[model samples]
Target: MSDQVDVVVIGSGINGLVAAAELAKAGWSVALLERNDLLGGFIATEERTLPGYLHDTYSSWHPLFVSGPAYAALGEDLHRHGLEYRNTDYLVTASVADDGRTTLAYRDPERTAGLFADSRDGEAYLAAVNGFLKIAEPFGALLGSELRSPSTILKGLKLARAAGIGLLRDTVTSGRAYCRREFHGDEVDHLWSPWLLHAGLSPDHAAGGLMIPVLAATMHGFGLPVVAGGSTGLIEAFGKLFAELGVQVHTGTHVERVVVEGGRAVGVVAAGRRIKARRAVLASCTPTALVRDLLPRDAVEARFAERAERFRYGRAAMQIHVALSEPPAWSDALLGRIPLIHLSDGSGSTGIACAQAEAGLLPAKPTVVVGQQHVLDPSRVPRGAAALWLQLQEVPFAPAGDAAGELDTSNGWTRELADAYATRVLDRVAAHAPGLAATIRAVDVVTPVDLAAHNVNAVHGDPYGGAGELDQSFLWRPGPRGTVPGLWHIGASTHPGPGLGGASGHLVAQRLLG
Candidate 1:
């Protein structure tokens, strides 16, 4: 196994697979390694309770598919490999009250505004949609995009100008406080903050608050689309493309360490076997995981070590997947047909998300984002049934008071916590779909522990490798002057930051070959 090759890529996550496929397509002999039976890190699928039902493990929606001249270079590869997308129109924002669920935002933003037009503030909140888009339109143009310098702002500006008047000015100020001030009810704030989280922003945070308008603006332009199969299908599709291109993909094998000589990565030792590479070794993981664990600690910089020790990473969510006997009955016919619905509970959904990530405790009400993928593609569930996913933000990863954020999943009550959260989510679903609780033929739970156990790449179930902070992006990521020549990274944890778009993978490929 220590034989020479062009490149050795550790981890079979989407970015790693895509990078490997691109390298192989470019005529380089590449080998992709994974520790689990599955190939995707967050992109895998499962059928936990029942035999036939399929559930997306992590990501189910991707509207901002990476497309541009950079991706266009792949040519027929994209279409031929079954990489397809479909859109839907459904946004459900509810306010849980003693009376009943007051759906703040139902059909579209206009319809939602109409619901909010009771007072002057409410009417203003509703009417602000158009004015909000004034800013959102330009931000959408940069989705999963490459950063441009001041000289290149014209490219982005040209796209915004194409959107029409007023949109650019809206971009100048994100309507966080504006929406809060205008909307008389907290429901309106709940309605918009989830959109901000979709953009990798925290709802309560300032810079993050601006993301709501941007998310709404992006979705307003491009519909939220789910792939027909499961999220794993995306990874499998990439793997199939790799197979056709003759890339070597080996699963269930984890690389123990990188064989570095004179500060240059030359090979890898995995499963007690050594495999040498001729050109480079790329890690589809966080820099801390790669350098501290795999390389000689003496070679790493003191600053990187210090940052790794203190950088915050409290984000961890548990997913509850249920296969129901019948589709949950929602009073809103529109929500039943939409692909994604956000359940705010009581507190601002975005606030709970950010707070839990910092405090590391379950939010009292627990903000959740629920997805019924079957709404868009019925094939995920069995005939005459629905596949549902409930994601909660409050599940703790490691013990809160631990010296460094270390999560020991070996504990007992973690599952108890997951069970409690899962029941509440299921109850919420039961309200929407009567008899859903009784019809739970099969139920599967993915704890932060299970996720990390599956692949250390996810590091405590933080599927997102690094903090998706504004400061730690673009060339500043892993610091572009190449940590080591012939070495690179492109994944959820990398620049252009997380989620379905293949921007980072495409960038890494272009960076190496371009």
Candidate 2:
């Protein structure tokens, strides 16, 4: 490999991969470095439980990627290199309460609204989603671009004129409040409230009112898509594209520090070798890590470093993969066909769980994200068998105690504790699917500690980089331009916060290329 390149990208997450591929395609020599042996950071697929069941280890859905500008740029290339997606045309997702009431969401908004009890709620639901769609282009552009840029200001102005005062008011209102004001029925809240967790927000958090409509519009427009074979298929496709573009990939290479001279980032010292970067060095890492560990103390201002130190992380997360002997026998037979379902009862229950997790206690009834990947892609499991990708977003990294007071929290996230929590989550699922416990052949649990150990970017087991509070989001988010010249920052930690969007990386690459 050459000792020098046009750009040196640190970390091989979705952000790093996108930046490297885009730059290399633009005829710039790029080198991508990864600490792990594998290239994909969070996106991985493995047979966690049984040989035939292929499970997405971390993130599964791709609604954001399919709808983002990154996909608009690279989707054709990725598809050419063996990237295929499986999506349902009708049933996308649903939510079920303990009382066996199921609220379904379809690809068609009118069809989904028809399921609501009150006809007014159906009308309100349609209005909220369609209202957002009218300004979706400008809103999406503002989120995808550099927030502090002049172009962003114009986009925001355009959006304000189109959306009026309601958009501004919704930014500060909580999802709970938005649902209460918009619709009398609990159906809309029950279906979309749990989705806030995916954005690193709670049902009661600010900006959720805005996010709920965005989520509804996205799911309805794109549908929930998973890669054809596994989530790793996207990574494999990127690998093929990288090779075709002549991008150098160095896996198992830990970049120790950025080499700065004359207040400019010239390269990185990885594996005790100094590989020079003639153009730029993009670090796909947490702001704290970039300011504290990667760069020299004198490279950045002290206040910036201190602010990075204060970068708060939200609640921890856990993944439970279950291999079922057969499909779960849900009490509501319709639930068996939905791609994803949440065990939540709107803000009333989900709010309590978020509060408990923040207070360092295990939630008694945590919002469970049940993903049925096999329903969209039958190749994920053996014929006549199934698997469940269960996600627990409302979890404490270090539990003070269990809210149910059943598990021992003396030891933080030990194997026994994780197993006990897994049992609780499964029991919650079993409530909706009476035969769930009986159908399980094997269960593999990935606790918060496991998440932290697996990916350095997942600080404190927060897979979304950092907390997405109003203070840390939008114009306040860290931009690509760092204090040091030729250094850029991208990833979940940057603006356009988390999810499978890859917006941060795409934004940074466009900045460099322009």
lDDT of 2 by residue, 1-514 (tens): 6899999999999989889988998999999999999988889999999999999999999999999988888999999999999999989999888787889999999999998999999999999999999999989988888987777888989889999999989999999999999998899999999999988899999999999999999999999999998999999999999999999999999999999999999999999999999999999999989988899999998878887889898889999999998999999888889999999987888999999999999999999999999999999999999999999999999999989888899989999999989999999999989878889999999999999988999998998898888888998778677568999999999998888888999999999999
lDDT score, candidate 1:
0.63
lDDT of 1 by residue, 1-514 (tens): 4367888988876667666877888988888888787787777777766877888777677665533323455525755777665566555334433234555554376666666546665466544545556544354445434454453376567665655544434333333564554456665565666555555445544444345554554555556666667766567567678878877778888888888778777888888888888887777777667667776676556776665555344366678888888887766565676666676643355565457655655444455677888877888887998878877655567635322233332453377656765776677666655666777777778888887777675666665665554555443455322455556656766666666665566666655666
Q: lDDT per model, in order?
A: 0.63, 0.92
| TM-score (all chains, Cα) for each model | 0.82, 0.99
Clash pairs detected, candidate 2: none
Instruction: Provide the lowest-lDDT 10-residue window in model 2.
Output: 475-484
TM-score between model 1 and native: 0.82
* Among all candidates shown, the one with the greatest lDDT: 2
Model 2, which residues run further than 4 Å from truth? none
Q: Count the backbone clashes (under 3 Å) in each candidate.
A: 8, 0
